[model samples]
Target: MTLHRTAILCLTLTAGAASAEQLADLHLNIVPRTDAEAARIASVIAPTTDFTQPEKFEDNSAGAATVRPRANADAFSQASGNMSFERELDFKLGNGLFKKLWVSSPSSTLASDGLGPLYNARSCQRCHLKDGRGHPPETADDSAVSLLIRVSVPAPTAAEIEGYFATMPDPTYGGQIQDFGIAGHPAEATVNVTYSEEAVALSDGEVAHLRTPTFTLTNPGYGAFRDDLMISPRIAPQMIGLGLLEAIPAADILANADPDDADGDGISGKAQIVMSAVYDQPMLGRFGLKAGKPSIWEQSAGAFAGDIGISTTLHPAGYGDCTEAQTACRTAPDGATEVHDNAEIGDDGLTLVTFYSQNLGVPARRDLNNTQVLRGKQVFYETGCIDCHTPKHVTHRLEDQPEQSFQLIWPYSDLLLHDMGPGLADKRPDGRADGQEWRTPPLWGIGLTQQVSGHSNFLHDGRARSLLEAVLWHGGEAAPHRQAVIDMPKPDRDALIRFLESL
Candidate 1:
């Protein structure tokens, strides 16, 4: 093998096989931090104690990449604030590709064909509407455009169980349920959900209703699912500050991990490790609801193939998630050609989309100085929410990704997997995330969910109708925090929500 290939192989093996402390440099293009620069970063990233007023640069959650808050639904659609005009063009091009609608193969559009014989959505934008969070179908008639059901089965053998990462796609239905299919092809399945509500009384007689969602797969195209099939419902999270999240050093994230609860903090965040499709190496999984994909590129590639049924270099299969059992679907014509690097969407296309996703600018915090917001901020911090939802991190100085490099970003996430208790469990093991574990999603642009997504649904399965409902669903490691909220004074609880909205 060539030296470059050997190096890559070694990196892949070492990162995947070794402990978190032994993690090698997965991002090779980064510039190492100087001692003085490192000291400054350490000082700035320290958790704040004084909550009398907003801390310095607290409004700029994405640091230099944060955009000014807009008073419309397009708030989440801006490019990185620090990006150059030349790079802005690339971001727009990526936005176009992101919203590009694909059709079935043998169509006139050469650049946009090869849609799934069986698929979920036509484009990335379909799921992540307006670059914001996606909600579950509101009514029975409403289609599940943004919500997708992931189906997997238990590994029959121990060999397939690699560390915490174990589970394979259902034998007949494949990885995810595809609700849409081109003509002459059968779609995988249709998803339906029924919810039963339970009212929980709070400290000051305020009752919060939590919905328990029971997802059902009706009208299965192939056949009955396996008895032991594990299903997980996922809603597309908002797209902002992803690049900043990716730039956070793996060691810093791993430092927060206490899988054994060694710190006695009741917050044992575990690092989700997965093989990177882009680097061909093991990387810290920071994206996806379960922290499955390592990098934005890999996540985008997987979405392109899995969600849209569009082939990319990373996932070259033309039929997308179609298994060999679906002979007709597998034999379907694809949009692959030599000009497009033998995949429907080539490297250039994928790179452009990744760039667009990476630079989705986070909006600056709102109402940082409001008395109630400040009180809520204190409540949030004092309630131990910061134990898992870490507030600040200094990103690596990168030679290439200038927009995300060396910036102190407030993603409000440690990007580590935490067991959120069985109340919020999906009962599906994805990569390093167990059934009850989920990555602490960043709260940067969460306050604007209703403004941008046209709804206020939160959580992995969109079961939480409000932020408080989402908070009440927290279990396991966050049970104490949840109880604290439940037992807090009504004014303090209201302030806490106000502070979260200011984010």
Candidate 2:
């Protein structure tokens, strides 16, 4: 009787709330053949302890049909949890483009040539290994395949904003310092980094040591850089749920913006707005360390141009990453623009690659019923951690974009900029983000960083080797939350970490 009653109730719920339909179908193993039927079944699906409870698993994790719990080192590499069960071939195609190695022009391989006159890594997978976060160099000789330094000199006059000078590209170095080049060309320069340890005594009589890195250049192959060179270090972040994040409507994102702390809360989360190169209209910047780029499409094209030195339709230059100062490099052969109608990676390539990027699945939450995680979840909210690391968002509806259509998600971020104080400041402005400000990075899949990326380093530069170190370094708006964590008993702190790991 109990089993029979529950089934009938679930059927009723599934037919009532279309928003919960994806999971209802998963739990019931019933596929509605027609759109109308599917919506009805999804609408009425009732909640259950094992499946339907809102907090039982992450909201996005609930609807993810392809959720992989057993796979690690590849956790962040899965297709969207809700990815149609039958569309794996498209996923594989995107994965191929993601891992394909680009080569220099004048090569026998027509499809793969046009790698670089100057570049960082040969392929996307070189940096975002296993589709996870990149780590800082452990040693000077370590190939910084995953790490790159962004160089700029102050813009004498603010490009658009008053009292704020935008970045000016170095006449010789350009926007970034590329350390690798084709065989005939010399590598740009050698980079060396050293860390100085700073210690902090917690209220619990425990101490945490923080490492700060200082970068130095040696054996300049290009030439001298600007005396006022503003250098910023950035490492590649994970590539899961990017489409979902991008799908989160700009209006929904702005609904969380509190730039003036207008609500009397100390946390001031400001949205970073930048004019889009692709659209020529101002759009919210959602990707990159500083939230510098607007759309996933542009971000991908920018990476193709900047990181691998492969020119695409957006960046049609044949001399990838080469400035006018480098004459031989610019004149060198280029396949993307020279041979491929002014674009090495044509529309097809970009579409396939972008499609693959958009579908990377977020792994399901583990141990959601665990007691420690539950306690930490509460502490996360009570101690004001939720103020900045916001949770819960119902994504927007996008017609014809089924992969990224209406769905509930929990990215644990406001996706807005916050002043992180001096400890984390790159002192470089991007669009509306100030030097000390950075977009609050989403915390989903952060727990699996070591499993996926082979490292647990965090923050924009990967300086925080552990999550706690990342927390302790917080200041400005997040200072109070940091203080709360430090003041908590070891058990509570452990519980908080447990909650984060469950994500």
Candidate 3:
């Protein structure tokens, strides 16, 4: 189906009744003006170190040294002058085992200490392969089914601090059945999709086709489920330059928080404050669609626990939905509750895995100087896409690291949550974020996601089949921009898409 027709159908189903001019006026002035204010507003994008020159310390300087310290004099001096670009690449390249851990496992493996008694995927790589994009649903069998599940209980009114698991309780097994299971057990769940097709007539006399998804679970292993148990299906997101994202200072992220809609942009960029499992303190979340976790270490660790049933220092337990009748499951240690005999295989392994994921170098821009790409970049900014997809941030200085030293990097995300409206709302709260809010996903290496991750599914869930569909799905703070995109001429629209592909 043509893009214009599909957008019209989507609009017919859920477009707000408000007029265009009124919607445009909303949040019009929310964007920062001067570079200083923009830098302050997007402090998260500021360079953490003065990278114009190498740093010097008063105490470290040797007075009037005619010659540098020899190798025999100080090992530090010998190591300082010599740099190994090859070693740096080796360090940045992910360990083969970690890559295997991210990729090789299935959603149902029983490794005594790994895989899942209950999980969304067997390996981290299964969801986010090569740390790239996932394909959206095309066929019934091939549709993207794995999505993040969220559960929340009411906050306590008293002064007592809740226990770790108290705030977020696991859903009852049958309530949120794992679609895949171990060898002996029945596949606990099944997802069925029914599409309702809508056709729209465009201004150019062309037709656009769109489909709305209706989900149903058939032959559930457990009995009937609760309607109140909110379900959210999130397709895996691309993992690139996450280390730099983690290195961004917290003060920088907070400088951009506009929680109360104070400026009335309708696009309130709120910070989701989450309890960090690693830091053991409340932190401003910068990862996940809702910005639920503060750092990549915790995010990777939690995924290991929740998605792969791998226990680490952070999450020291496993989860499965087996009845008392299932003696083997009941008696057996379903998952690793602590780091086992292999000290190296525990949190250290997870840390290395995170480092690999964090440090996966973003490839250089492709077709950057091309006319189509340049036109697309202009259209991208002119259509107000740049509001959320703010495009550059410099990294903090790394102590003792020569290769990862301060450098300007372009990861097109504001790293803050904005209301995506009902079109994309999963109706589930995560950390401090409301049901409708989602973090603006980074756009670096987005064009190459299909080659790397093997899929083109965009957004939190694999709802949008293509980038155009993904753009059409925008709403809430992005509704005006989405409409503007819809209303653009075919050439302009194609230019915008070409620009996206060039990214």
Best by lDDT: 1
Ranked by TM-score from best down, the candidates are 1, 2, 3
lDDT of model 3 at residue 438? 89
Winner on TM-score between 1 and 2 is 1
Cα lDDT, model 1, residue 455: 91
The local distance difference test score of each candidate is 0.86, 0.73, 0.54
What TM-score does structure 3 among the candidates reach?
0.73
lDDT of 3 at 394: 46
Span of ten consecutive residues with least summed lDDT in model 1: 1-10
Q: Tell me how far the alpha carbon of residue 201 in candidate 2 is from the true structure, in angstroms, after superposition.
A: 1.7
TM-score, structure 2 vs. true:
0.87
Candidate 3 C-alpha lDDT tens digits along 157-176: 42122211223433344223
Higher-scoring candidate on lDDT, 1 or 2: 1
